[model samples]
Target: MSKLGQIGAKLHRGEVSYDFIGHRKLWFGISIALVVISLGGLFARGLALGIEFKGGVEYEAKVKVTDSTVQDFGDAVKATNAKDLGDPVVTTINDEKVRVQTKPLAQADIGTVRAAIAKEAGIPAEQVTSQQIGASWGQQIADKAILALIVFLVLVFGVIWVYFREAKASMAAIIALVHDVTITVGVYALIGFDVTPATVIGVLTILGYSLYDTVVVFDKVRENTRGITGSNRYTYSDATNLAVNQTVVRSINTTVTALLPVGAILVVGTVVLGTGPLKDLSLALFVGIAVGAYSSIFIAPSLLAVFKEREPGMQALNKRVTAKKAQLAAAAAAPVGVATVGAPAGAAARSDVQDTPRKADRATGAAPAPSSRPMKAAAAGRPQPTRKPRSKRGK
Candidate 1:
C-alpha cells in the first residue's frame, strides 16, 4: 500500500494520532490572532458593497466605431466634475457596450453625466440609458438578510444541542461555525470583494455546512465514549482523540469532493465571466468549506475535550486513565521472568499471578482463587467406569 494509505488506516484504527486536544491552547491563540486581524481589516477598510446595496445610478451605451475606448469613459465622466457624486465604475460588456455605475445622483445631473459619457464615446445622447436607485430599498433587503441570519443561527444552535445532548458540543460547533464566517467575511473586507445578495446567501449556506461537519465529528466522539466511565482503559479526551482520528479521512474526502466543484465555479466565473454573482457565491463557499473542515478536525473536538476535562467527574476519570497508562508503561519496560533470588517458590508464583492484567478481576469483582486439583487430570487416559452386573438381574 502507499504511504498515505497506510497512514490513513493507522489513524482510522486509533493506532496513530496527533495530539490536537493536548495542544489546543496553541490553536486557540492562532484563531484569536486571525480573528483580530480580520476584525481590524473590517473596521479599517470595510467591505465594498455592490451598487444594489448602496443605491447608485447605472448608465449603459454602445460605443461608435470612432468612439474612445472604455478606458477613457471613467475620465470623461469625471471631467463633468459633478459635486457629491462618488467615482464612476466603468466596465466593458462584450466588445461594443460600456457600462458606468456611480453613487446616487440628482435628476438633473443624470442627464449631464449621460451626455458627457455619450460625447466621449462618440455615440448619440439618446443611445445612453440611465436609471436612478433608492437607498431605502437596499436597506430593507439588508435588514431582512440580517434577520434571516439570526433565525438560522438560533435554529442551528437548538438542533445541534438537541441532537448531541451536550451543551459543550453544541457550543463548540457554533463557535467553529462563527469562526468560519468571521474569517470568510474578513477576507471580503480585506480584499474589497463586493457584498452582493449572492454573498449573503453563500455565508448562510456555509453555516449549515460547517455545522454538519462539526456534528459528524461530535457524533463519533459520543459513540466512542459511551460507557467510557465504567473502566479506566481510556479517558474522555482519549476517546475524543480516537474519534477525531477515525473520522479524519472521511472529512478530508468530503471536503475535497465538495471543493472541486466550488473551485471550478470560482475560476470559471471570475476568469471567463468576470465579476458577477457566480464568482461571489463560489468564493464564499470555497473559503467557508475549507475552514469548516479544518475546524471539524482540529478545533471542534479539541474544544469539546477541553470543556469536558474541566468537570470533576472527567478529571477523576482522566487521573485513573493516566495512572493505568503509567503502570502499563512501567510493566512493559521492566525485565520479564527474572524472579528474585532466594524468594520462596510459592511467593514468586503468587507474584506472577498478581502481575497479570486485572481486567477480568475488576469486572468480576474478584481475583481467581488458586486451584488445589491439577489443571488436567494426572492420567492422560480417560477414567474407567465401574459397572455392577447385578443391576441387570434386579431390573
Candidate 2:
C-alpha cells in the first residue's frame, strides 16, 4: 500500500489519531476569535451591496481603453450633479466598456447623465445605454433570498435530526453552517466585495457543501460511538476524536479538490475579467468553501462531542474508563517480585481475577456483588506435570 493508504489504515484502526475532541477548547477559542474579528469587520465596514440589492441606475459607455477612462467617466457623471445621483461607481469591463452605477435617478436626470457620459466618451447619447432598477424589486429579491435561507436551514435541521435521531448532532451541524456563513459574509464585508445575486447563490451552495461535509463526519462519529455506553474502552470524546481522525484525510482531500477550480475562477475573474458576476460569485464561493471545510472538521464534531459528553450515560462511561486506565497503570508500575515471605503466591493473582468480573460488569451496566470467598493458597513446592516419552507411549 502507498504511504497515504497505510496512514489511513492506521487511523481507521485507532493506531494513529488526532485529539480534536480532547483539545476542543483550543479549536473553540480559535473559532471564537475569528468570529469576533469577523463581527467587528462586519459592523465597521459593512457590505458593499450591488445595484441588484440596492436599486440604482446603471450606464454602460463604450470607449477606447485608457488608464484615465474610469476617472474621466466618473468625473463626467458626477459633473452632471443631478438630483439623487449620489456617488457614481465607475469600473471597466474587460477594458472595453466603462460601467457606471448611481442611485436611482429621474428620467431627465438619467438623460442628462447619459449625455454627459456620451460627450466625454466622444459617442452619441444613444450609444450609452441606461437601465433604471427599482428599490422595490431589490427588496423583493432580498426577501426571497432570506426566505430561501430560512427554509434551507430548517430543512437541514430536520434532515439531520431525522437521519441521526440525535438532536445534538443536528444542532452542532447547524451551528457550523451558521459559522461558515457568518465568516463568509464578514470576509466579504471586510474586503468590500459586492454583494450581488450571484454572491447569494454562492453562499447557498456553500451551505450545502458545509452540511454535506459535517454529515460525513457525523456519520463516522455515530458509527464509532454505537454501543459506546456498554464499553469502557472509549469515552464519547475518545470515540469522537477517533472519528475525526478517521475522516480528516477524506475531508482535506475533498476540500482541496473543491477549492482548486474555485481558486482558478476567482483568479481569472478578478484578474482577467475585471469586475462582474464571475468575480462576485467566485469570491463568495472561495471564501465560503474554505471556511465551511474548517468549521465542519473543527467546529461541528468538537461541539457534538461536548454535547454528548454531557449525557449521564457518557459521564458514567467516562468515569469507568478513567478508573480502569488508572488501575492498569498502577498495576503496570508495581514492582515485580515484591511478594514478602509467607505471602500466598496466588494472593495478587487472585485479586486481579476477582477484580476482572467486577470491572466487566460495571462496563456493561451490570451490578455484581463482590465475592467474599478466600482464595486457596498455592502449594509451596508443587511438582510440574511431565509429558510421557514418545517411545514408551508407542510401546
**Where does candidate 2 clash, by residue pair?**
none
> Could you estimate the TM-score for every candidate?
0.76, 0.79
Question: Which regions in candidate 1 have their CA more than 4 angstroms from the true location?
Answer: 1-6, 60-100, 115-129, 337-395
RMSD of 1: 10.7
> Which numbered prediction scores highest in lDDT against the true structure?
2
Off by over 4 Å in 2: 1-5, 60-100, 106-108, 116-123, 340-395
What are the per-residue Cα lDDT tens digits for candidate 2 across 17-50?
A: 8888877899899989888989999999988888
Tell how far residue 79 is off in model 2, in angstroms: 7.2
Best by TM-score: 2
Residue 77 error for model 1, in Å?
5.3
Instruction: Give the Å error, residue 61, model 2.
Output: 6.7
On a 0 to 1 TM-score scale, where does candidate 2 land against the true structure? Answer: 0.79
